[model samples]
Target: MSDIIRRDPRAEWIARNRLHPLHAAMQPAQHSWMGPNGVIRKNVHGVGFIGPNGIKRIDRSGAQQGGATKRTAAVEVQLPLHQVPSPAFYINVVPDMVGGRLSSHDRDLLGLARQLAGSDGAVLAVVFGEHKESAFATAGVDRLLVLEGHEFDGYSPEQRVQGLRAVDQQFNPRHWLLPDSRSGGGELGRRFAASLKERPATRVWQIKGEECIGRAGAGQQDLARPLPRLILAAAECADPISDTRHEVLPVALSTALARSLPRIEDLGAVAVDPAAIPMAEAEFIFSGGNGVKDWALFHQTAAALGATEGASRVAVDDGFMARDRQVGASGTWVTARVYVAVGISGAIQHLQGIGACDKVVAINLDPGCDMIKRADLSVIGESAAILQALIDAVQTYRSGAKRDAA
Candidate 1:
């Protein structure tokens, strides 16, 4: 039409018209083409494309591309039914002036009872004073049997044994769980086990499956009995899982039975130092090691800090401290809020005991020792010199506090 001339304009138009159906048939339904670098490009409907080298990769699904998918069905686990002992008893005899409240040790025994007796099984808690039903119910006990009287005011070994015997005869429980407390539970449990001619595992700390394990001598041991008749559990062994709403059962004691129990002679009690709290229950502990030479200064520092005294195995073996005060794998394990290790060359056994401590402060001659490395704060120095300085600092602080108060 302008400068260009078409020799076959009519023929070209005719050819295009004829080829239209053929081009349509040759083309694919879904569009796909090769990229410039020989990579294949695909449309939205295509799952993947074949590369030039014959490698295939899938495209990201909607779920993987930041879109939420419908949640899958939950899978249910099948739990085996454990057959629990029927009519299990958790006996607790409160001490005089304790207001009939359950101690931590007593609560542990009740917890073991609840664990042994599943949700459906009957777990009865027996007490010898007037107590709130909510207390036992909060500990997951199914029932409470309270025997309240003036005669049951004070704790007596003889009275406890008699009451336990009477209750045993009445209920005839298959299993009896008692607290292995030094106050009175240990004695009661031993005597009861002896009367029944059954050997009980004392101070049990772990109950896995059907086997009960605890510290024995210098190490741990397990007792696997098909059915345990009686168990004296440690306070650290079990924790309470309260879920049951308990029923209160008040058992009235006959005057004859109550009076038949012999009265214990009241002896004046001696006051114990607050710092003499057991290592297991101590909030703060000041421990001495073999390198400590000035024992007097060490003790003075402990007193100033209101800390319980503890010793390493080497110190105990050398007669620097009592064997009972030794803290280690071969000794008593302690759980404290703060533990101060003075002059201790950290051994593996010693570390095991203080493993539960919240904050550990180590003062040793060598900073490369295990205790210093594991400690939250480390002070490298002679033990005796450090102890004296600490004592003096504490005294100055106390004097300043008193002055401020005045």
Candidate 2:
């Protein structure tokens, strides 16, 4: 037996090394085995060593008793700075009703500033209302120029132009980004461009590097080129990235300069229609077409659903809805969360306006219509009946929810 065992390489090696039985146990075994000490052990493929009690489980209570350890420090992301050819300025025109808070479009202007200036270049923001340093800092604005005095309180077109002129004379920014919005931004941009004797590219939707792209003329041709001295960017163009913070240099306005500026007669506050909400700002839009009858009931149903009323070009042309409420290529573009089209035939122009809508619901008598095809959900029925049913269902759900909450 000794001669035969000595001849075997495995037994000879084990004998020569004088290895312990526990050392052999540590090797990957097929299954669990009891050792000399009556301890059952196993070497699992993925799992670490399992003791006699089986796989050791982490005890939550024990861990809680031990308390938490210190967390690792956050790693900072370093971005390379770019050198801009010239300074860029953002014009922030505030309305009194806004309570000094920056609008979404205003924030977009800041985003544009960051895009233009990058990490090193200075980005200036010129505002007419109350200046919030923290807000501009969060927006990555390098400098803040607040226009003070009663003349800058409201949306006075002439007063705003004078304020913009003051900033222009001081900085002489090569690129000026203005909001291309319904809240007097478009009008202001046009007037500013005319005053400066520079053609402003309006409704600009994209800014790649130093170039700006947007729709131009009645045909709405795609216009893309090196950014002009002035640009009126649409709200959808630059999404606000509030991730970075910057130290903003505050600039003091000269009281003498502000006083000496030509002042135009303040057109007293214009009355606002409570029922009318701009399509761009509306969260939910209920649009009607020529196929919709009982226009009054249609509008009432919209009000019941807490949706802003919109209209197809045909409906507006037929005098069923106001021209301002028209949703099409020639009309205001809406980026609502939900858009309900009642009796709308889904013209290409009409569909273009609702392109940004998250969910589209179409109620049309024609099953083969484009609206039905494009809609997330389509209901084939009479427009009037469908709208009334939707209104009733929504009201019932609301009442039920309220009762449950109570």
Candidate 3:
């Protein structure tokens, strides 16, 4: 019989070797001007806001007239380089589709870029097509890079990455910024940083340095060399104060390249797993928000409706709901057959991901809230009352159907 309790000599050696810790004193601690965890410590001199218009949208209305053009291609006519600053901060717009309608996530992306641009950084706002002219105009970004597209050519990730690489190689920015959404923008931004061998940061609420990382190959042998990449995801953080009201900004890429250079082990690209988003199969979904005023009532409402309950990040953050059910840009992006927003103010970041539902019912006391405007059916009332009524209505309908069947 085999010795069941005895371990092999090789197994014992492997386990012991794994447990051996590296010498603490030999490894130098990383130093930063900001706090240990703070990513932004240096003053940003230049920034880049690059938008890759790889896909172009043709005017379907003029399809018969052969007036077809790519949407992403229109970047050329919109943002001329001379209009931009010597080393302007760049902002790129990434387009998205939700629920058969164009989503407003790109607006949020522009908003983030605009906020970054408002600092002492020259802003270069890039657009894919004429669609974003108004968005940039409203955001008040003056300089633009608008690249025109071929009629059939659409947004390509590799192409955008190359365009960004070209600009960064020349300008060398201090801070590179982009949205953290799924539709190619986030991927391209990070890939550009990796291709440039700079630290690629994402979900970044804020940044101030050009330090990035790049990788050549896999495994210990490859890591033995000086790896040149740093990818950051910057979606989670408390709000920070931004002062863009007074100062004229510098170029994003140029300043980043000039400053914020740190000596450290080359941190590889922060890998982001493709979000395995599960589509909501339910016909009706009940979602609550911080505005519910009563967390218990929110749960009661969901239970009463026999509907799955979902909460906004605020509710989840405050311990009202499980983090698993939180819905927003940083949370689960859900698409249900029917979606009901309860006591939720439809913020652009939150609404962009969910607007794809076939039917939307909003229950809120605030008639002025944007959710009311976007909902297919808006019930201007308290969530508790509205939820109770809905539950009752559903129960009654079920009973009637059962009776008819009998």
Candidate 4:
């Protein structure tokens, strides 16, 4: 009996049998407390005994309780859609799109493009080849133009330049925005600008009413100039769009794009150890701190998740991790896409280090910690249990995915 998974039959029966003697005992506890506006009430998360799957399972079908799903639906944020029926002009953006997803740099550029487009113009995104990103609508793209072809795949900058030229000839956008980042965007933007015989703003950080301010003289001075047609913007040039959504309407060129002969041969990605990667360059970071009780388990968890390991200042000082692995203002500042802080209390220095990270997930016992307040997602619980459960979940997902693939 101890080994078998118990069903929530009693809860299920009581939901249907409301007139029974003890129906209320098994019924789901709901939000009956008065809301803010005096007597107003809302039915938010319902309470019941944990089911076999760790959620309340009863006859009620309306309450769906997958852990991830519940968290996302907690606030039910619906950004208002921004649509442009007829655009006066176009502001184009080419994202680095590292790993087939929009980086923080990409989103920031889109936000800048949104500012440039305003209400009259549209923010158009130019994607080379296929991508896995589905959030272009929320990322402030009014029009999405994906130039898909084998010729555009893998280190083919010459081919990509030709594709951009074709877009320019057809759309003749008012502005071209690309990230002045190490991951291909900067070089490509410069190449495209040269093709069009237009001088581009490079390493651009900010834009004023009619002038653009960018770094000059080895980051010693800021160069202000009139806004140019082409811009290679740096990270954090603008905040990403969060208040509204865009149409993301698909667009295509009328004529076939010109093809360029390949000067660079395509080589696939090379494997590197997660430990060998520096925190500054890592995409996913799993960090630990003083609250962690099991160091071995934490290391195992990081490995299972395939994340680069990082540690708080306290953890490094305590000799739990290497000094090189410390993450803070005094340590390495990271711009990881997803930063999971296991037990770190959010120090100001630590927060500053990860300020540029896109998402922060905090797992700790204390819900009121500074880390919890700063985290995009917070899971308040015992670290050991959470880590173990996470490892199991990852294994399950991988196994399921492999089975489906096979």
lDDT scores of the candidates, listed in order: 0.66, 0.68, 0.50, 0.85
The lDDT ranking, best first, is 4, 2, 1, 3
User: Which of the numbered candidates is closest to the native, going by highest lDDT?
Assistant: 4
TM-score of each: 0.45, 0.48, 0.36, 0.75
Better of 2 and 4 by lDDT: 4
- Model 4 TM-score? 0.75
What is candidate 1's lDDT per residue for 1-406, written digit by digit as tens?
5998758665555444423434322333554543221224344234454421233434343544766553344643222222324444433322211235665456556666666765445665667766643565455555556665666555566666677777777766667887776656788789878887889887776677777875565444554544366888875455543323355344444434545737575464565563578888776889999889999888888888878999999999999999888998799888666789998888878987886565799998976666986799999999888888898898999999999999
Query: What does the lDDT read for residue 374 in candidate 1?
Result: 75
- Model 3 regions lying over 4 Å from their true place: 1-120, 130-133, 151-155, 169-172, 206-233, 236-406
Error of 4 at 352 (Å): 1.9
Looking at model 1, report the run of 10 residues with the lowest lDDT sum. 90-99
Global Cα lDDT for candidate 2: 0.68
lDDT of 4 by residue, 85-177 (tens): 999999999999888899888987998898898889999999998899999998889999999999987888899999999899899999999
Arrange candidates, best TM-score first.
4, 2, 1, 3
Evaluate model 1: give its lDDT: 0.66
Top TM-score prediction, candidate number: 4
Candidate 4 residue 171 C-alpha distance from true site, Å? 0.3
